[model samples]
Target chain A: MIVAEQKPIDEIKKMVAPYQKLLILGCGTCVKTCFAGGEDEVAVLASALRLSFKKDGKKIEIEEKTIERQCENEFIQEAASCVARNQAVLSLGCGAGVQDIARQFAKVPVLPGLNTTFIGVQERPGLFTEECVGCGNCELALYGGICPITRCSKKLLNGPCGGSQNGICEVDPSVECAWQLIIDRLKTLGQLDNIRAYIPPKDWRSSNSGGPRKLVREDHII
Target chain B: MKTSPSNLQKTLENGKFAVTAECGPPRGANVKVVRQKAELLKGVVDAVNVTDNQTAIVRMSSIAASAHLVQMGLEPVMQMVVRDRNRIALQSDILGAWSLGIKNILCLSGDHQTFGSQPDAMNVFDIDSMNLLRMVKNMRDNGKDMSGFELNEAPQMFIGAAANPFADPFEYRVIRLAKKIEAGADFIQTQCIYNMKRFKEWIRLSREEGLTEKVYILAGVTPLKSAGMAKFMNNRVAGMDVPEDVIKRMEGVPKEKAVAEGLKICLETIAELREIKGISGVHIMAIEWEEKVAEIVKAAGLQK
Candidate 1:
């Protein structure tokens, strides 16, 4: 899932300072799961902003609204009335969602309230770690499902780089070495030979290297 | 068979004990400092490495500094890090550096942005060092760009990469080296060597894999300026293993003569490194003290 963290209150306040009427649009999918831009978070943030404005003797109207997913045009259409009522929208979504909202509501100024971090999984409650870098070519099958691209600090295809101490990366002691995990997993599966194969350098064309990516489906075109 | 005008490559090819040095470009636009440092290393080393925003700190572009060095008649290894640039920018810079007569390129996965002045900065790690090596190799060998498009004229670059022997998963370090060689790395410059025992073991394992014949391995060495610096590197720097005895030796030295003692230690390490079978040369990274390079290289008897 796409993970993101809320911007600091001061920065968010400054961003919305110019607008008299603002809409805090929340994303229900990725940002919702990450607790950055969700229904509850938007309410909490709106209340805090209201309290802050009230303390400063300022008058402003702030509305909280969330859609199923901001990336899709259909979901973004649900917030049309709120977007029309407000001078600007403070999108609490991933980068893609923020852009999507901006594209859909051409005249309204869409501001990002969350910093999209990475595509990761929740290791446990309240703890999230990045897992995939979305490097067009996926080689997880060869490494026994452990991605060397996102897991290794160096993104070494033929790692673990010299910094894995006791299965922990030298960069961060808390972070487990991706290669060590791969080795262990491969060992368990009796697939140690898989690692021995020299994985050549990856082709970054499919990644963000070329430019912004676009997916097209001919069968679903209609 | 000749391609680049890199003296470092020539020295390594001739089976000679090559010596290279590193110089971090100034944080601001000060080409004079870079020129002075390049002049200092003129005849002292085989090539001078121009670091790309080393330690995540913003500095003058390595390519620009390397171009200046090329004009000064000094062969420079243009350090290109993956942290600050996407593939588009990286390829463009590589081509620009080549057009400027800069031949050597050292690909590195730069230090994370958090370590630098701009902690809030977004990093563009479009490709890692290994892939950078492959990209450069393809551009040089196949005369094509990342998209398999043909280039008007491909750059002839002597590609280099970095290795940290002191990093964790010690046993896997050699395997990584082999992979780098396979990825088209013509040479490698390692992280600073303070723990000789571990480095020797790494070299032994590398030799067993016959990787020594595939690529030139230059062991990195940095002279300790003071006991505090030694302690800082030992404790704070990730992947750095400053030996306890080396720290103790630096501590044993008097305050006024600590640098001298450190230089002596560096000389001894370089001498010992020359004896290691797989070790081809020494890469002296006299950070911020480029003036001491000539003296250290001369004292180490690496001046050819």
Candidate 2:
């Protein structure tokens, strides 16, 4: 899913002011399911911009496009046919989708209408919270089923920070302590002793910390 | 329709006894039904509300129909749902109504489409109704949107939000109503009420919990047309409670007298609410029974 967040409407309005013709692009993947940058959002944003401009007595043309998937280059072509005389493209997709579109047409400015939020899953209806960070390393086997990278403030590889009071994160009190979650999961799995074993320090260099990460597979290669 | 700005304030200061009415849009595009109902209460009602998909069922747009009410010399409170649109659409409709010079707006989270015509329709609840109210107030008061960003010029409108009187336990419902008032609601139009004693007790808690000074509380009175329909509301609609006594009253009345008896019950409820401290007005949700709205208001002896 293309994870995304929404920016302030005025900021977006200011960014698209000069361009009378614009495309409001929406992604139908992750952000769509999360109710962030979706087809309905694209229509609404387009309509809002139309109204905002009308309030100032300035009229503009807004074209809406909903691509099947925006994070991939293969799906980026869906927007190419619609980018005519449009000086600015308001991408309602996630960061990856925006980057893919921007890179394809380097001359035109691709502005994100959404703020990319996080890698996560929908726990229930009308709610979503971060649950994972793709560190190119699988460490859940060591820490139960919880991801320390995203949930834990320090990404503590070996232990919890001393500031975890009442089993809540010190960084943001709303966040559940990662170690606390790991301990709860272990208790559920009847393996609380797993926390007593020796755990190796996480090498930050091997994860997202060092640089932009990539992958290549021979079986998927054409 | 003729209440001057000063007169409205004087009424509020004198606290003029008021009666509000609800007129739901038809389940389809047929305007004849709603138009006929509007004609029935063209003069005797305070305001005719245009509900936007009351049960989340698709109908003629509320704004267009409310515009019709305004043309018919009735003040139309346009009901908007945050569950159907994002902050973007919510603001757009608000501005659209403002540009048309429509001032009174009723903000709602709306019935989730799961409870409406299409259960599988994708619901866009990126914003709640409270945030929607804040957005409208932002345009007028802070000259900003829901995100604390500036607007070109704010729309000055009287904003209203919903509260469920019979939804949760008495204390929880009162606390939530208090919270809604604190969020800058000019007035509150609540869910249906059958037991005025329970409603009176709920209003009593509002007094004990300090909710009166903030805003006006408009008690909702939905006049029942049939006992079967009353049972349908209590069973299917979440947060709606029609007491068994009201059901028995509905069953005891003959087909011809049921509607009149229902109107009497609503008038009595409104009169009872007026006795309680801090109860401001009555929002009559007569539904398809909009013809009886005038009768109820007249029977309750509310303001013209």
Model 2 chain B: lowest-lDDT 10 consecutive positions: B1-10
What lDDT tens digits, residue by residue, belong to model 1 across residues B1-304? Answer: 3455578888999989888999889988989999888888888889999999988899899999999998998999999988888788999998899899899999888887777799789877666777788899999999999889998889989999889888766766787788788888999999999899989888888988999989999999999999999999988776788989999999998999999999999999998998888788999999999999989987877776
Docking class of 2: incorrect
| Candidate 2 displacement at residue B30 in angstroms | 5.2
Clashing pairs in 1: A162-B167, A162-B168, A163-B168, A164-B168, A164-B169
Off by over 4 Å in 1: A2-118, A133-137, A151-180, A187-222, B1-5, B142-154
Instruction: Give all candidates' CA lDDT scores.
Output: 0.88, 0.73
In candidate 2, the residue pairs with backbone N, CA or C atoms under 3 Å apart (3 or more residues apart, or in different chains) clash, namely A1-A30, A2-A30, A5-A115
> How many clashes in each structure?
5, 3
